[model samples]
Target: MIAVGDKAPSFHLAASRDRVVDSGDLAGRPYLLYFYPKADTPGCTTQACGIQEALPQLGKLGLVVIGVSPDPVAQIDAFADKFNLEFPLASDPDHGLADAYGTWVEKKNYGRTYFGMERSSFLVGADGIVKNVWRKVKPEAHAVLVAEAASKL
Candidate 1:
């Protein structure tokens, strides 16, 4: 997994039917890149909503928030509409971006094993280096913590 100070892996992903968010598009800007397992799921919803609520504070720090999920563009669009999310939520259907960020992993649930995304978040600086990382992040309070960290960046 990528650690603090490492350069974040580059990616260009579909954020909406009409918009594509690329790492190069965000160059020289600090941002938070968060990975979640699924769209509209309980934990993921909590995390996304929390980030939405914290947008004001995060904006003060000049941090752009981008949520990444292996879900398709249509599903992501539904999720964003349902939650009134104001940030970009990118689709990573093939797991390429997830693999690059080390968020893809072997997961075991209810006696079934599969490869899935591990809830993770990265704080990347304006220069494109990872400032902090949260692996297997808990959704309930992660946004608050991330906002705090970004404020210090």
Candidate 2:
């Protein structure tokens, strides 16, 4: 798993507007890279809204937020539009990036087990090194916690 001080894995994924968002594209800016299991789910929605609410504060700290999911581009566009999420939502359909970041794992639901992306977030500094990692995060207070981490970046 990627840890603090480790270089963030390079990626180039499809995003809203058919744009490609690459890790190298974020050079010279601190960024919040969050991974959620799916798009448009209740928990994911709440977490995204929280991040949207905190975007202003986070932007003041020079932090850019990017959310990733294994969902496709069409779904991501809908989710972003429905929630008015101003940040980029990257599509990771093959789970390459998630595996690279160690966010993909076996998950449990009601005694059933499956493989999916864990609710994880990473704070990547301008230098492209991970500053912090939050694994299996809870939706509530997630944005505030991420904001706090960005403040210290």
Candidate 3:
């Protein structure tokens, strides 16, 4: 996974509807880049909603939150709408973005081995250098942790 002091990889990703979140546009601003296994699933839902609730505070701290998942645009759109999520939830269907951040990894579940996202997050500063990282994130109370980190930045 991405670590502190690393320069973040640039990206132009699709968000809900016709919206797009581009790294170029977010330059000189602190932002949170998070990876979730899937959209609208139990754990993912918990994390997304928590982030949603923290949006106002995060905004006040000059932080933008963008979520990434291995689902397609349609699914991401549906999930955002269903949950009333205002933050950008980018679709990374091919896992290219996840690969760049090293969140796509090997996993063993139910005696099955596979490659998937490792619920994680990165805090990128205004200069595009990663300031903090969270790996194997727990869905619950994620917002508080994220907020605390952003406050320090």
Candidate 4:
């Protein structure tokens, strides 16, 4: 997995509201890149909402938020609309983003095993270096914690 001080992997993803968010364009700007298993799901929804609530503080810190999931652009749009989320909820249909960030891995659930995205978040500083990394992040307090960390950056 990408760790603190590592340069974040570059990506150009299709996001909600028919937008495209690219790492290259965010150069010299701080950002929070968060990976989730699926859109509109319980945990994902909670995390998204929490992040949305933190947008004011995050924006003041000049930290752009980008959410990534394995779902398609259409589904991401639906979820964003349902929650009134303002940040980019990107689609990673090929799992390339997840793989690049090392969020893709073997997962076991209900006596079954499969490949899926691990709930994680990366805080990248203005210089494009990863400032902090959170793996298996708790959905409830993730945004608050991330904001606190970003403030330190």
lDDT of 2 by residue, 20-63 (tens): 88888899989988999888999999999999999999999999
Best lDDT among the predictions, by candidate number: 4
Candidate 3, residue 60: Cα displacement in angstroms equals 0.5
lDDT of each: 0.94, 0.93, 0.93, 0.95
List residue ranges in candidate 1 displaced over 4 A. none
The model with the greater lDDT, 2 or 4, is 4
Pull out the clashing pairs in model 1.
none
lDDT of 4 by residue, 1-153 (tens): 799989899999889999999999999999999999999999999999999999999999989999999999999999999999999999999999899999999999999999999999999999999999999999998999999999998
lDDT of 1 by residue, 87-134 (tens): 999999999999998999999999999999999999999999999999
The collision pairs in model 2 are none
Top TM-score: which candidate number? 4
User: How many clashes (backbone N, Cα, C below 3 Å) per candidate?
Assistant: 0, 0, 0, 0
